[model samples]
Target: MKKFIIAPSVLSANYMNLKNDLTQCLENDINWIHYDVMDYDFVPNLTFGSKILQDITSQIKMNIDIHFMVKVKTKNFTDFFVEYIKANPQMMTMHIESMNAKETKLFIDLCKKNNIKASLAVSPQTPIKKIIKYLPIIDNILVMTVEPGFGGQSFIEHAAGKIGLLRKIIDQNNYKTTIEVDGGINSETSKIVKDYGVDIIVAGSYLFGQKDFAQRAKKLAGGN
Candidate 1:
């Protein structure tokens, strides 16, 4: 099994004091930062682009995990995929709901060629079977606990079952793919997510809303 990790989402961070928040998270021993890349076509909201990602990466030593929610057009995705991989990120994820199986495999191959871990992301309504075939090659599986558009949403309880099933498939095949759960993750919901076999927890509002960022990060990581 992979080591547990708590990734604080930058989408919820105070943009005016972004570096300070990231520093505080690191002070708490939290080394993974989750970036949500949204293109208005795939998701209703628009968020960080390469400029913002570049800016953040330039200042931080922590591992970066990008969640891409954009149009599934092959050419466009390939271009964006190349750009994100150039950042030499720890992981880059694409929505299984957005692309066809062939595109998903191609994206994974591209990431591998660039030495970046490729992850498959699924929305709450997407069936687990849609992503199972890619699990053997993917480094991670991002199970969205809420819709992909925005942050500060409630946890969709059924997402737990989806994660459990994916875990079973990974275990049965003896694959090393890590299961990551995102959206609506706070202290209490994270506990439920752990019970469902999530290896990485992505928390946005729950983490950034608090004043004690370090302590909040520690608690989310299951520390004392």
Candidate 2:
């Protein structure tokens, strides 16, 4: 069986002790430390940037996975993020829907040149086909269960079919890309999602919000 990578998203971490919060993710054997780098243009909420990543790189040992939830601009932040990747970033990516086709390709190519793992995400409302058009250029697909920006929303049931369809498309086309599912991925629902064959699970509220945060994260890691 393929290994299930557990990436604990840090959007819900306590800002006061963000480094300490990341320390817990390191303790749990989580696969990657996910950063939700959002700008207000793409989504309603805006999240932290290189300042937070600087703190994380100075302290943590786990692999870094960046989800750039920002609108495509004059390569300002992307230039900053390329600098982040230079500091040994394991995975750095941006939103496909946030930029136009030409820009998306350019961004992915830039990330690849910088040796940062490139990925793209889609909201529950966007068609998976739009994402597939860019698949040959990207490395992973972040399929959202809940809407971006905020957590604590119910998982949309309709997304299950989309996941299954994406799986078929990936396999048939021989794409070596990972299928990552974020939001609402708890132990119970995660097991159910096993049927859809996701490779990475990005857990946010489900991980950091728990009392026994480390063990709960390992539990969601699902049997090694």
Candidate 3:
């Protein structure tokens, strides 16, 4: 069986004091720092950019998952990808929406050359078939329960159905791509999602905003 990874999202962390919040994840041995990169145009809200990622990447030992939420842009993303991969290779994923199908495939190919773990993300409103086209090229699949720009949004219950669909497809095709679910992954929901074939669950508010961040992180990591 594949491991169930708990990548805590920074979207729910207190922006005023990110270091301390990130420290919580490190202290608990959470392996991946799931960062959400959003542009104001793509998702209606903007998030901290590459500079912050550069700073944080230097401090953390765990592999980072840079989930780019912006619509795929080929030229603009080239240098950013080059730089981020230079800082920490083999763990970033640019969103499929950021580029067209051909461009997305090319982006994943670029990541392969640079040793980055490329991934594709899809919004709830977007049809699942759009993501299916790039399934063979990308390393992971991020199924967004809520809209991707900001945190605090509730997980769409129907999102679980997509997991079942992808799981079946993967099974039938013998695909190795990991299935990841982001947004509202608390202890209760994590169990529910895991049962539905969600291999990686990104928990932000569920971990960072808690009083016992360490314990919560452990519970999530242990899939309790």
Candidate 4:
């Protein structure tokens, strides 16, 4: 069987006891945590900055999957993420819609310089062709099943077709790039994406909203 990772998104985590929640994840054997960074300008909603990310990384031993939903400009890529880079996440993902080709390459190079895995994210409406050229170079690809800004939305059924196409391309090219899907990833949707070749599953409300986090996470991992 292929390896499947369940990365619980911190967006739906309990802020009052954030560390405790994260510790529970680690105890449950789920090591990767999906951290979403949203700038109000890029996604209409505002999320945490590098300082908070640094705080989380400093305390938790879990791998941080930083998804930057903010806009990236060529002039300010480094400046905007200097502190985030210091946090030293396991992987950093940026949206293809946020940057031009030059900026995208610059972001990937920046990740390489810092020894962080670079990944590109595509929104539900954006076609796979937009980032086809990047599949070989990037470490992973994030396919957002719902809109990027908020959580708790239903999974878009049409995104499955996109996942299938991406899987076909990756298999044909023999690329090592992994596919990650976010939003509305409950037991049912998890199975759908897993069949379509998703290696990583990002669950927000579905995981955090439940009392038994480990059980839900195991189900998302394709357990019976």
Candidate 5:
């Protein structure tokens, strides 16, 4: 079995003491940080951009996973993509629901050219069929467990089915795509996601809301 990744979503970390919280996560042996990038147009919210990501990247040794929840619009989208590539995250994912097939391929190729592992994400309502063709090129697939844009929404129970279907498609194609689950991933939801062959579990409030982060990390990483 693949060692499941317990990636704490930085969106839920206290922004006032963000660096310290990040350092705490590192000290607790949690090595992956999930960055949820949202643009108000695409997801009804605005979030950190390249500058903040650069600051965090400079400060930590942990792997950074950038989840782009923005629609591809204007030349600015390409500019931001360049900035994200420069930030050099371990993985950079964009939503398939936001772009056409050609654009998705272009961005994935762009990430590959920059040596970043490219990923494609889909919302709860998006069908696996939308991204299945891109599976051969994408290194990972993020299945949103809740509607995108927010941090603390409840996990859509049926999202597990999406992950399971994705797992099957990946296996059938013999592709080495890492399946990731985000949103509403507490200890209980973690089990369901893991059972569906999810490789990375992105937890936000469940990991950061508590004072005992170390224990929370352990529980999130421990699956049946």
Candidate 6:
């Protein structure tokens, strides 16, 4: 079995003490940080951008897993992509619904040029087959267990099937790709995803909402 990674999403962290929250994760031996970049147009909520990401990464040396929740057709989408790429996150995931074939290839190529792992994200309602063609090229696939817009939602149980199918496809093709799941992930949901072959777990409210982040993180990572 693959060792599951516990990535605490900064979206649910206390904004005023963001640095402390992130540092706490590192202190607890958790290395991956899930950063959600939302542009009000694609999703209903708007989130922080590259400058903030740079600031956090400068202070804390953690593996940054950025999820881009924005529309590709937006006027400044490229600008946003370039700026984020400059931050040099370990991995970056863009929504499959936002880009077409050409745009997807362009995004993946940019990540390769910069030596950053590129990933495709699929919403809860999206079919698993939507990203099959790109599986061999991308480094990872982020399966959203809940709707993309907000956090603290219940896990969509049916998404587990998608995770299973993705794992089978990756194994059958011997692709060097990983599977990551985000949104509404708690201790229970973590088990479900892990059983289905999720390599990384992105937990927002469930991990950050409680006072004991380390304890929650350990549980989510399948540690006792």
Per-model C-alpha lDDT, please?
A: 0.85, 0.77, 0.78, 0.89, 0.87, 0.87
Q: After superposing candidate 5 on the true structure, give the runs of residues whose Cα lies further than 4 Å from its correct spot.
A: none
How high a TM-score does candidate 1 get?
Answer: 0.94
lDDT of candidate 3 over 1-224, digit per residue (tens): 44678888888888789888877776777778788888786789888777787887788677788888776554664655666665674466666566776667677877888878878887777778888867776788888888778787788878767888998888788888889998877878877788788888898888887898877777776744
Q: Candidate 2 clashing pairs?
A: none
Q: Which ten residues in a row have the lowest lDDT in candidate 1?
A: 72-81
lDDT of 1 by residue, 1-224 (tens): 33579888889999999988899888888899999999899999999887777777887898999999988655555776666665668999989878876777778988888888889899999888887777888899999999998889999999768888887888999999999999898878887888888899999998885877666676777732
C-alpha lDDT of residue 223 in model 4: 42
Q: What does candidate 5's lDDT look like per residue over 83-186, in tens digits? A: 76667799999999888777887888888888888999989998898888788888999999999999999999887689999888889979999999999998
The local lDDT score (0 to 100) that residue 78 gets in candidate 5 is: 61
Models, CA RMSD each: 1.9, 2.1, 2.0, 1.3, 1.3, 1.6
Which residue pairs clash in candidate 1? none
Candidate 4 TM-score to native: 0.96
For all predicted structures, in order, the TM-scores are 0.94, 0.91, 0.90, 0.96, 0.96, 0.95
- The candidate with the higher lDDT, 2 or 5, is 5
- Could you say which candidate leads in TM-score? 4
> In model 1, which runs have C-alpha deviations exceeding 4 angstroms?
1-3, 72-77
lDDT of 2 by residue, 1-224 (tens): 56788888888788787777777776777648788888898888988877668767776677888887878566553564555665577787666678777777777887788777788888888899788877777888888888888766677767755778888889999998888888787777787566788888888888775798867876777653
- Poorly placed runs, candidate 3 (over 4 Å): 72-77
lDDT of 4: 0.89
Q: Of the candidates shown, which would achieve the greatest lDDT relative to the real structure? A: 4
Tens digits of lDDT, candidate 4, 138-174: 9999999998999899999897668899999999999
